[model samples]
Target: MMKNTRYITATVLDGNRLEIETPDLPIGQTIEVILVIPETLQASLTLSDRYAFLKLPIAERQKVLSMQAEAMIEHYENNTEWKDLMTGDIVEYSEP
Candidate 1:
C-alpha cells in the first residue's frame, strides 16, 4: 500500500499539547504523528552547545531535554520579578 505524507509546522502549546490542522485530510481519518524537535529550538541551545549535546546517546539526550523543559517551567512558575527588559515579543530562534 502506498502512503501520502504531509509536513506541517506547529507550536507546542501549554501542557505539551499540539494543535494540528489538516484541511486536506478527511475528518476522522487515521493519521500518523511523528514529533520532530528541530535542533534550533531544542532548549534554545547555541550551535556549539547543540553539537556537544548531539554527542550524547539518544536516550541521554531525551532525558536532558526533559529535565531542561521541567526546569524552565519551574523557573517561570517561581519567578515573580518582571523587568522591563523582559517585556518583548518572542522572536523566532535560529542558529548562526
Candidate 2:
C-alpha cells in the first residue's frame, strides 16, 4: 500500500527530464510521477531563452544551467518555501 504523497516543484534538466528532491524512499519501492508544466514555464522554453542562455559566459551560464538531482536535493534541503501539503501553510523562499 502507498504510504504518503509529497509534492515538489522542480526545474527540467535535460529535455523531458525533471529534477525533484524529497526524502529517500525504500529501495524497492514502486512510485508514480506526475508532471504539470505551467504556461509561464512553457514560455521560458522558447528559442529566445535558449539563445540568451547560449550567449552567457561559461561561468554565468553554468549557474543558470539546470540542477542535477543531487544538486536539487541540496537546494531543497536548504529551501524555506517548501509547503506543507497537510496543513496548507506556505513559507517564503527565494533563489539566490
Candidate 3:
C-alpha cells in the first residue's frame, strides 16, 4: 500500500521515454512531455537569461536539448527554482 507522499525511491536510468514514475499509477497509461522552448530563444542561442541551453555546461546542455526542454521551473512554482544540477552540483531532496 502507499504509505505517504514522503516515501519514494529514486533511481537513475537512461532511455528515450520520459523517466517519471509517479507512485500508484498504472504502468501502461499514456503520458506526454512537451518541449516549449520559444522560437525567439531558439533563433538566438547565443543569449543568456532567455536561452537556457546557452547557459548550461556541454553535457548538461546536450541532455536539456535532447529532452527538448520545456518550461522554466519558475513556471511551475513560484518558490521553487531549478538549480543547475550539472553546473551547480547541488542536489536537493526530501527525506522519505
Q: Give the C-alpha miss distance for residue 15 in model 2, angstroms.
A: 4.1
For candidate 2, write residues 1-96 as lDDT tens digits: 534656677776788677765559776678765443454565658798678668878865543343234446766789757745447557899999
- C-alpha positional error of residue 96 in candidate 2 after TM-score superposition, expressed in Å: 58
Candidate structures ordered by TM-score, highest first: 1, 2, 3
Candidate 2, residue 30: Cα displacement in angstroms equals 1.2
Error of 3 at 56 (Å): 0.9
Off by over 4 Å in 1: 40-96
Clashing pairs in 3: none
Candidate 2: which stretches are off by over 4 Å?
Answer: 1-3, 41-96
Clashes of each: 0, 0, 0
Best-fitting candidate, scored by lDDT: 1
TM-score of each: 0.40, 0.33, 0.24
| Best-first order by lDDT | 1, 2, 3
lDDT of each: 0.72, 0.61, 0.49
Off by over 4 Å in 3: 1-21, 24-46, 50-52, 69-96
TM-score of candidate 1 against the unseen true structure: 0.40
TM for candidate 3 is: 0.24
lDDT of 1 by residue, 1-89 (tens): 65575656789899999999888889899986645565466677679976877997896677667655765676668875755568989
